[model samples]
Target: MAPMSLQDLVASLPTGETWGPAASEEKTLNGVPYAPFSKGDKLGRMADWTAEGRDKERGGRQQYTRNYRDQIYGAGTQTGFEIQQTEENTFSLVDNTRTTKTRGFGRGGGTVFRGRGQRGAQTQRGGRGTFQRVGGRGGQQGYDSRGGRGGGRGGRRFGWKDYDKPQRNRDASVVAKPDWKLLEEIDFARLMKLNLETSEGEDIDNYGFLYYYDRTFDKQPGAPTSQRKLNIIERAAYNVTTSDDPVIQELAEKDEATIFATDNILSMLMCAPRSVYSWDLVINRQGNKIYIDKRDGSNLDMVTVNENAAEAPMETTESTKDAINSPQALMMEATRINYMFPNQTVVESETSKREMQNPHPFYNPAEESDPPASKSYKYRRFDLSLEKDDEPLHLIVRTELDAVVKNNINGDDQYLTIKALNEFDNKAQGSGGALDWRTKLASQRGAVVATEMKNNSCKLARWTVQSILANADLMKLGFVSRTNPKSPDSHVILGVLGYKPREFAAQMNLNLANGWGIVRTIADICLQKPEGKYVLVKDPNKPVLRLYEVPQSTFEEDGEDMSVARTGDDDDE
Candidate 1:
């Protein structure tokens, strides 16, 4: 009486009281009484009866009733439940003790009829109509002892077969969004030098940003099944002009210029192999044939001359033998090349961050009309060539083009710009699992940058993959993001975009090193650009040791065919 607790007061209340948990009692459904908030007893009995298997000795009508009841209501052994006809042709479950009636399926007790009713059929007829579960959850098509078939008036109910039926092909139509021909016509040499075009057809200028579409499975014809839309990554957008004529400075200050960077670059590198031969070509117009420039590796004097010579014929023979020896592996490699930039441009500057997010720092703002200073650097093309014959099979990347000038340029005036380095050597030397190429490549500053870029690209790629697979819809569908997200670095060396962990490891071990190896030869040439010494890069594909020299003149002569010549004449169009 002093202070009644809630529990005590509830126990003290009368049965008809408004509160106090409503005097817990047996709840009933369809006349079948069950303990309030508990269906365990009823469900257990039903399950036990069904587990005993169907009783075949019962009378024909009784057997039909039992099977039909079990199919419709699942082990129909509810103690106080009775199946009764609520109408002339309709049936219902009635819990007589509880004085309750249920129509369709329910948690406690209910009547569920499968299959539609036929016009001339009734329960009194010669077993013409009987309930048969359709194609639904926990529903299976089965024949009733009394009914003619599984579905009423028919031998069987039509399920998925209706939709699966074949039909005539649809009419021809045009593609909604035409595929852009901009990347197709470019030669590999020029592709390395050209900037991406904006939606309005204006050049993004000086490697501002490249648009990356998810082409993981886009090798086949037609639109890609996944991630077909372009994702623009902004780099140098000082020259980009939108229809609104928005101020470029305002856009930059507002941080509106960049959409994505490291990820985009990583994606491009991942998809570099797709455009290997055509990387250097860009056709600003439709119907223009993609022509190769003099710098084309396939068109090089060494390639042409060597092909005509013993080395060329030997290469063809070796290639055929190699294909025959390992067709699957070689085919995989061919597919991989599409996503890798065998020849990549990695620009370095004194003030730019190691990430190299933007190349604007290398641009001369004072000379608004002039091209960026980075463009003036000779030997713009940095190529990564494979050497399958190497002891462990490695890659050698070098500049395909040479820096030539009429004036004798001293070493101090001209320098070798190591654009980018791809770590293709990643084989484990011993039990420690350390990459032999890592230590080998990190030997020089130039190679260090390339190694860092490669490693960092893997990190970025992993993160992007994680974010994409973490989507709720994707996860619900049982899509595995990665089997090993934290193991051996990405398989960029194999030119394969990393997806599953084990797959990446297998490919990496087969084709690449775990980390990176700074080719001392290439890095040394890149670091010490002194005039007398020539930068030597051995072409792994060719026997020739390509020699590059920096001329005395640091700048190009006016009217000199610059690195990229725009002779389309249809620039305005």
Candidate 2:
């Protein structure tokens, strides 16, 4: 057992065997090939650090335990493990080289990898694959289909908080019948582009008398001394429609004008582009004549408050808890104030009143108890003929004047058209951001007027157009406020302000040429049709005008009843 030489120890081993271990017959184990390695290499680890670095550079993770297996055995080497063939094994393949598809769940399930600077990266999971591109700055960013924000510069986005606003659904003033046939549909955009210049209309006849305007109301607003409680005066006032006026009918029979309308109806048509509420006009076409009329109890007779407001007063419903601030109540309150305000602000002395060429046409002293209000009716004629027309188109309108004021510069009488803007409650829901007129009218008059212009654009536009049509020398706007916010019966005149019609129109950016064009456009549509009655209606929810051909007997019943009533009154007189 002494220490032997290295060569003698190796020679003493059994044949086909080495000193370290038994020699194998082949370079394979259990039918699996062996991987070659150098003895100088370091011991293998459970995880390959080099493979981890390479996987990270590729921008993703590899299968779990794949790296460790490759390090220990070799790359692409599978252990010779197999299951015996059976019924379950015959259903699917045992090969791991191919990927197996998986079923997805929940709204196209897949992994969404969102990042920057890694382009052409794909993810496959749950039977779905998504190709993603992580782009850098200055590239087109992506957005979520569910309205999520994408990566980009930040600012206010479009349609932000659109869901928070309330929806407005208004009803039409008149319902359409099945027998009526639609003739034309026109939008406001097309009407705005039209233009027609008209001259100062000619005065055909004058009726009714106007008293002098009481200058006391022109005192400074919000002053304790200037405020006057509105008095309910008894006066005869008439709002005769065009076709119902006897004078207009006489003029029509004489062929004085081919087209006839009252100031109220004509002004509504002229300023139609500014309207928000639905309105309609009745057109009767006789032989070579056209008459623009309004139905009985039309909305044209009611004065609207905040009709053009962004958030107008809501209608009364079971869900609406507030009824005083509703649109119907507000309109009724405004109309009552307008009717009584002018009569209370005029001088009623017989010596001081200005008489027109004719007496009150619609007033009968024997039948009526109250005296007539200070109002004048002037029948004026305007030319709406185009250069290419074969015949001249003339429009005669029955315009009314409220009162007369003496000019300060020349001491001559100036005709005036009076209108009032009312306030119910500034703190109400649909006040349109109006200021308290009692405290702010004197100091911030301009601000109050600007707010009114924004809230009542359509209303004020109609009044101004009416004044211009009447050829009034001055347009007076009275500020009237409710004494109590809860009551509609009691009101007081805060003050009165005057503006020249043309100057006010310029301030409002009102184009007369555009208004004339609207009238002519509507008129031409009727002129081309056969002799019959037509109706022009304004859409409620949309800014459009629809012309329909109605039957000749559409409004004949109401007209006949009105005729019978008038005849009975005349017989009693």
Best by lDDT: 2
lDDT of 2 by residue, 1-573 (tens): 699998997888788774465655567877876878787454534455465664564344654344333453343333444344568745754444322232222222232323322223212100001212233333333332212343344211222232364456666677677889999998876887889998999999999899999999999987878999999998889998888899999999889989999999998988887787778899999998999998765778878888765456776667763477787778878888889999988888899889999988899999999988889999999999889988888999999999999988999999999999999999997786689999999999999988888678778888999999999999999999999999888999999999999998888778889999999999888989999999898887777889999888775666653453233123212
Evaluate residue 131 in candidate 1 and report its C-alpha lDDT on the 0 to 100 scale: 18
TM-score of each model, paired residue for residue? 0.19, 0.71
Error of 1 at 499 (Å): 1.8
Q: Stretches of candidate 2 above 4 Å error?
A: 1-166, 319-322, 558-573
Question: How far off is model 2, as Cα RMSD?
Answer: 18.0
Candidate 2 whole-model C-alpha lDDT, 0 to 1: 0.77
Q: Give the whole-model CA lDDT for all candidates, comma-separated.
A: 0.24, 0.77
For residues 1-573, write the lDDT of model 1, one tens digit per residue.
499899998889888668447544566787677645443322424333432232443335465454444333334444533243467656554532221243322222233334322112112111111212233222443333223344543233333352353432211111111221111121123222323211111112222212212223223212123212211122221211111122322333443322111211222222221111111211011111111112111111110111111001121134454331121222232222212221121222334312113343334567565333222111111122234323221111111110111114442222111111222223311111113332332234334323332333332222222222111011000001111223212332211121332233343221121111212223223333332322222222221223344232211233332322221111111
Pairs of residues clashing in candidate 2: none
- Candidate 1 is scored at a TM of 0.19
Ten-residue region with minimum lDDT total, candidate 1: 472-481
Top TM-score prediction, candidate number: 2
